[model samples]
Target: MKVLHIIPSVAKVRGGPSKAVIEMVKALRSQNVDAEIVTTNDNGKDLLDVPLDILTDRLEEYGNVPIRFFSRFSPNLNAVREFAYSGALTAWLWQHITDYDIIHVHAIFSYASTIAMAIARIKNVPYINRPLGQLCEWSLQQSKLRKQIYLNIIERSNLLHSQSLHFTAEQEREEFHQLGLNIPNFVLPHGVHIPEPIPDAQDKLRQILQIPHQIPIILFMSRIHPKKGLEYLIPALSKFQDSNFAFVIAGNGESDYMNQIQDLLEKHRISDRTHLVGFVNGETKNLYLQGADLFVLTSHSENFGIAVIESLAAGTPVLITNGVAISPMVKEQDLGYVAQLDSEAIASTIQEFFEHPQVAKQKGDRAQQYIAEHYSWAKIAHSLINIYAKYAKYTKL
Candidate 1:
């Protein structure tokens, strides 16, 4: 089946949604599906260094998945840049959307996704909308009135007309249901990419970072934003200051917010124990994952914690908050620890992890098996194909 996945931006800075679609399309292609991606040349403050307005392969430097990068027409202004406006992309989709049997639009409230849905409707095409956690409560609270109006005027109508709403987690789907929109929806989480083994990666990474040997590493990897709840993390790490555990913060964000994190770390006097490493990828990222003792994400609202699964895939346990949608699975499967969104709960749970290091190791080992068996992209791609087949049959009827 010919499928097209449209995302606002596939830049690494965009986090999981970007990575998710790329890995997903790769898996879909491996299954012999004609799946490809289309996105803008939006790389946050800068544009992607790629040939624009045409299909290009190996832009992501991973596999042979075809991705068409269009020039982002957004001005220097951060507000407009975030919109990811692309006239070329819009024109291309307007004329070529019907070329594919199905369309998967990722993210809403953006120029590309919104226009893709509108054009798909106009062209009488079947499309699925993945809000990418935008519809969740904490996300909606960002621009309360503006989003409420946008939903009523533009998004809700588009959703109602679409074939389905694609949600990554049960919690995300449940939150959408509360909107009372009569749209067909399904839950499918993002899959993990199991990395190849790197010899003594843990020790190598520790030496590179100058962290002492045998010290446990608590990793907080994701886009550093207010939503990530770094305030709680500072104090949580502070609770174990005398214990000599290393806290690593991977990922980057706005300078203003990043400075705030620095201040928070200093305020709690855990600055010495914490290492704020800017965006990590490739071998460096894998090393951090492989070496981490606990992967902690104290997000206020997470659609699905991709890093959690990746850490698990690397035989590292996770400690997540209830705000993360997958916390239930993490707890139910006994993969790792789950705690409330406060400092006390997080600190106490972390203490539990350190007290019984053997138990954490056992959990990590179980998590590795669980991730490989269930969270692999190849397996998820098959289920997605089945979903598409079901819809295709309904369309014929």
Candidate 2:
């Protein structure tokens, strides 16, 4: 199958969706499917420093999947920020969209997704849309008026005409259903790739934090955004003022907002205990995940918690909020703790975990086994192939 996955950009700064699409395509390729991705060099606050208008070896180290990067149109900052406007990408899709058997567009409210869906329909090529939680209730409320107008006039028709929709979680699909567009969608969560153990990961992390081995590392590895609920996490963690745990903040975001969060940590009198490691990837990221005593993400809205599952797959325990779609699974499978959105509730869970840290580590065995059996990209890619074949045939092109 010649499948083309369309997304604005695979920049890690865009958070989970961007990262997810890259792995998704890599998994499909491993199954011997001719899967490719077409995206812009949009890294937010900076364009990706890569060769444009062609597939590059930029991400070959991360995953060998082929990706064609188009130049992002940036005369108007608003257009780039809100829409990720790229006339170059739009024109390319218009010309080559039908070359693929099927198109899988990720996210709505973006130039890449909106234009691809429209062009796919015009060329009579079947397409699938992964809303990436844009149609969910909380997402709709942001820039409410602008999105409502866009949906009614453009995206809604594109969605109704698509062959099918793909949602990563049942909750994501159900929430999109509430929008009442009545499109066909299947729930298929993103798959996890297990990390190999780093022998000195524990010691490496402690050394980086400049702390002793006895000090427990409580990690928050994700994009530093308001949506991450750091407002709740910092205050909750501040309650641990005298505790021996070292809170490590990973990932990066806008400077102003990042400064504001740092201020919050200082105001709560926990800055001394906090270690800010701005953005991490590759082995550095793995070291932190593997070495952490506990991982946490208290997101106010998350379609799926890729980081949470990855932590478990890396043999670490996680503590997450019910706002994360995977919380129920984490709770049911005994993978980790699930706390209410309230700060007190989140703090309470952390306190309990610290009191019985061994119990949390014991759950690592179940967590690793569960992720291995259930969240393999190989299994997921086969299932998605069945869906694609139904609409695109074995080799539609």
Query: lDDT for each of the candidates?
Result: 0.87, 0.88
Once fitted onto the true fold, the runs of candidate 1 whose alpha carbons sit more than 4 angstroms away are 60-63, 392-397
Clashing pairs in model 1, backbone N/Cα/C closer than 3 A: none
Which residue segments of model 2 deviate by more than 4 Å? 393-397
* Per-candidate TM-score against the hidden true structure: 0.96, 0.96
Alpha-carbon lDDT of model 1: 0.87
Where's the lowest-lDDT run of ten residues in candidate 1? 388-397
Q: What does the lDDT come to for candidate 2?
A: 0.88
Clashes of each: 0, 0
